[model samples]
Target: MSYLPDRVPLHGPKFAADPHAAYAELRRMGPVGRVELSPGAPAYLVTDYRAALDLLHDTDTWSKDTRPWQQNQPADSPLVPMLGWRPNALFNDGKAHERYRSVITDSYALIEPHQLRRQVSKVANQLIGEFAAAGEADLIGQYARRLPLLLFHAQFGADDQEGPRLEADMAGMLDSQPDKAIQANINFANYITELIRSKRLQRGQDLTSWFMDHPAALTPDELADQIVLTMLAGNEPTANLIGNALSRMLSNPAYYSSLSSGALTAHDAINDVLRNEPPMANYSAHVPRHAVHFHGTWIRPHELVLVSYHAANTEPGPTADEKTAGGDDGAHLAWAAGPHSCPVKKPATLIATVAIEQLTRRLHDLELGVPRNELRWRPGGFHRALAQLPARFTPIAPDPDGVSPWTSSSPYSSTRQDKTWSPKPPACATSGPLYG
Candidate 1:
């Protein structure tokens, strides 16, 4: 495989600052272009919508197993921790993929949508209560990043106290630093190992126990892999989805008011993010099973190919008006496509939608503390994430009865007898200077 001398590097502040520009440049190279994930790691990025769909659906030509390509990568490469072959459904094909995927699909199936929404609401309220009195908070740190971890802990039967440690480890693993990423992977593995061990000794009505009890009969190691895969895949992306959707809605006042007024829904914001700024932007790694010319680029057997969900979804084509007139929202590839598409999209969507709704309802006057353009995007190749989402709101005091705002009948209370979930515009000005 002849390498392109001018491969675009996907890491560092430049790409993060303006990834759309990078995608636009890559489009000039045709549907697919050469790009470096890290300094020395080169891979082909599919920047066209049709090409990405073709690659994702062509299981016959492309394979998910990464072992062959992994052999050539440096042991300490930051990409190794993320792209290296694991025994989970993500790195397998055909029957093996089905076997591993079934465990996840079946386990998630046990979590009903209503039950998951209630759990998300509970976690969201707790997170909100922590910062409700402060008047200012980093939503990323205080809420978006932590809510999914707590929810996953509850589902996996891990103690709530363990959430912080897991969050730290997961962050380290995704940070794109070789040493920290590698060490975090080890720590995360140990954490899962212990969780599985405890579950064996005392099974509970949790995801871990369900995986163990499933008729598929995953071995202890297999169970650990699935758990790690599920947690890593579910937590980070969901967190980013929530943050990105919040950022979009908060940045645009008209959209925010429409959301609050129930004229526009959280689902609309989420779908907009999915199309414009997907959380897991450039991922869904696939390698050709044999030498093949894909979209005019010659790919060798076992060479890495990644689908740029961001680029593909935003590829130049019909305008939103044109798409709407045609009754097409121009479906996005944010959840990926084909057989290996996100297994838990429904629950993930519920988590993000409820998270945004809960925050908006409780702190109805919330506004970004920093200008929208000044917000920092975390630098990484695979994830489209914000480093911080600082925001300010009018501080709400605890109820006279000393009950938390989440359950209190205070003016800012979120608790209501109506079980139905709907957006209600706050009884305050929606537009104002971000911070006084």
Candidate 2:
């Protein structure tokens, strides 16, 4: 007998707590099914691997525009903060998407990989230096969260003072409620406008300057929007990618040993994380140009269609041969696909790799400060992120040169017992802040 799964609610603490288990249930019901995003926003979620690819690639039939759906949505809906229309490539299609995407992708491509690696290493080392001496630190706030922001700031000609503010504003925009998120968006827009103006007056050796010279000749507003899109695309997902990979390494003894012993490469670990728990767990929302029957489910025209990367990667129907035979080793939708695929994927991967490699190499004995299960997953359906990656390593001396780039006020201190990190700590520990 065929089974009919109950309609699942995609928002709230329950879904965020253990989304994979929920996806497993959804797959059992059917590859495509109805689900509510937040309270009143209901949409169809695509859970199967084959179906997701089809939906992502068929942009001709499934446009990125959401005007059809937004016309009826309440002004105060929480999901609107996330899925609402914007002028950037993320929200447009056809010639507009091409124009925005051309400039953004070309600007990103100008940064040579080797040069980019040097910058990533520099930022990684500076961040590690700041926290390494403490012997115990929250990796998420101190390292994972700060590394990408600082790198982006450096490229945008922003200084250390701007780093924290940019991080906070973007975080608020990504994960806050409707009111706070909208305000954060406004603050960020103003900040970008100023940055672009500064670049126009005196061109710098940075992406912002390169963007100004591009042939697209974007208006000031378009320039600011594109920069915001590029920064947001790389910062949040890459941070979460690093965090999720570190969590897996610390929590699973076998994976840790493989990484330490060089049996598994950093790329391998990254691929594993991308497949099992992607940074953007639920994204690539598309609106069908017309009402159509997809995989036995009728989706209305312009309905918000979301792909669950976590579920697609874990679908149980594919045979071992099917899984390993044709697709690329990293054949996961974590980087997304089609024309709108992440443009900075190469740099993002390199950054995550160097960050993980540098941290483990510097603190050879680093271990999780809290129990594996006790680490709180932040509440959000759009991202799979750990609240804090508390970890402990042997204390080390501070840099003699006093040249560390970190702030004088260290966020981590050596308080935990001096032992190898444990995967089983008491459950009463509080969640750490998202940023230092």
Candidate 3:
């Protein structure tokens, strides 16, 4: 494949600071263009909507497994950790992919949507109650990141304390720091391994037990892989989804008021965020089955090809503005498409919506603590997430019964010190909370 001159780099502060501008620059070259993923790992980015759909749907020409490409690279290659082969559905194709995907979708279906919403609301309020007395909090660190983990932990039959540990380690793994990610991967695996062993001896009604007793009857290693996949898949993207939507709500008063005043809905705000700033921004990584020329770019067999969900959604054209509103079928690629598209999008959306509504209603005066421009986002080739979202609100009494309902019975529970009851920070002028 002929290397494109001045390939766009998808790392560092410049790209992380303003990725939309970078996408605009890449769109000028063409739909698909050569780009450097890291120092030496180069891949083709699909920045056009139509081309992205083509690539995702044409799985015969593109495979999800990365071993074909990794086979020739040195053992210490950087790409190995991020895109290395796994036995789970995310890294398989054809019959194997179908088998793994069935287990996930089926297990997830066991939980009702309303149940999921209730659980999310319960978790959301409990989290809010923790910092309600403090008057100040980093929403991303304290609330957004923890909510999904807590909910997932309950489902996994793990205790609440594991949530924070999983949240921190997963954050490190997702960010582009290789050393931290390597250690995190190992630590995360060990944690899941123990969870699996515990479940094997004493199963419960949780998703973990459901998977173990399922018809497929996954082995221990397979169960751990599936659990780790679900945790990693569910954690970062959901955290980012909640964080990004909150950022949009707090930053744009007009938009925030519209949603709160019944002029718009949380669903609308979520769709807008999904279109403009997708959680998994540059993901759905695949490798071509063989050397193929696509959109004037000669991509070799087994070369990394990433579909730019953010870029494709924002690609300038006649229909670029379609994503600003909801009810548009075939509008955004945020949930992706094809056989490998996210199956849990509905639940994910519900969690984000319920979270936003619960936080706004409970606090009633939440507003950004720092200037919008001062917010920092971690740099990476895949996810688009906020590093933190500090905010201020009226201080209220902390919930006396703030402990998670699932904490008491789970074998994985931990007795971490309670800090949510800390004293409130000094008061400041606060914007009146908006309600619909």
Which digits, one per residue and each the tens of the lDDT, describe model 1 over residues 25-133? 7887889999999988899999988788789889999999988789998766667768999989999999989888888787777666777777788788778888888
Looking at model 3, the pairs that clash are: none
How far off is residue 61 in model 3, in Å? 1.0
In candidate 1, position 162 carries an lDDT of 81
Cand. 3 TM to true fold: 0.86
Task: Give lDDT: candidate 1, residue 217.
Answer: 74
Q: Rate the local accuracy (lDDT) of all candidates.
A: 0.82, 0.76, 0.77
TM-score top scorer: 1
Best by lDDT: 1
Candidate order by decreasing lDDT: 1, 3, 2
Candidate 1 local distance difference test against the native: 0.82
Off by over 4 Å in 2: 1-6, 174-182, 258-261, 319-330, 404-436
The parts of candidate 3 lying over 4 Å away from their true place are 1-4, 172-180, 258-262, 320-329, 403-436
Worst 10 residues of 2 by lDDT: 420-429
Instruction: Work out candidate 2's RMSD over C-alphas.
Output: 9.7
User: How do the predictions measure up, each by TM-score?
Assistant: 0.90, 0.87, 0.86
Candidate 3 C-alpha error for residue 308, in Å: 0.1
lDDT of 3 at 270: 90
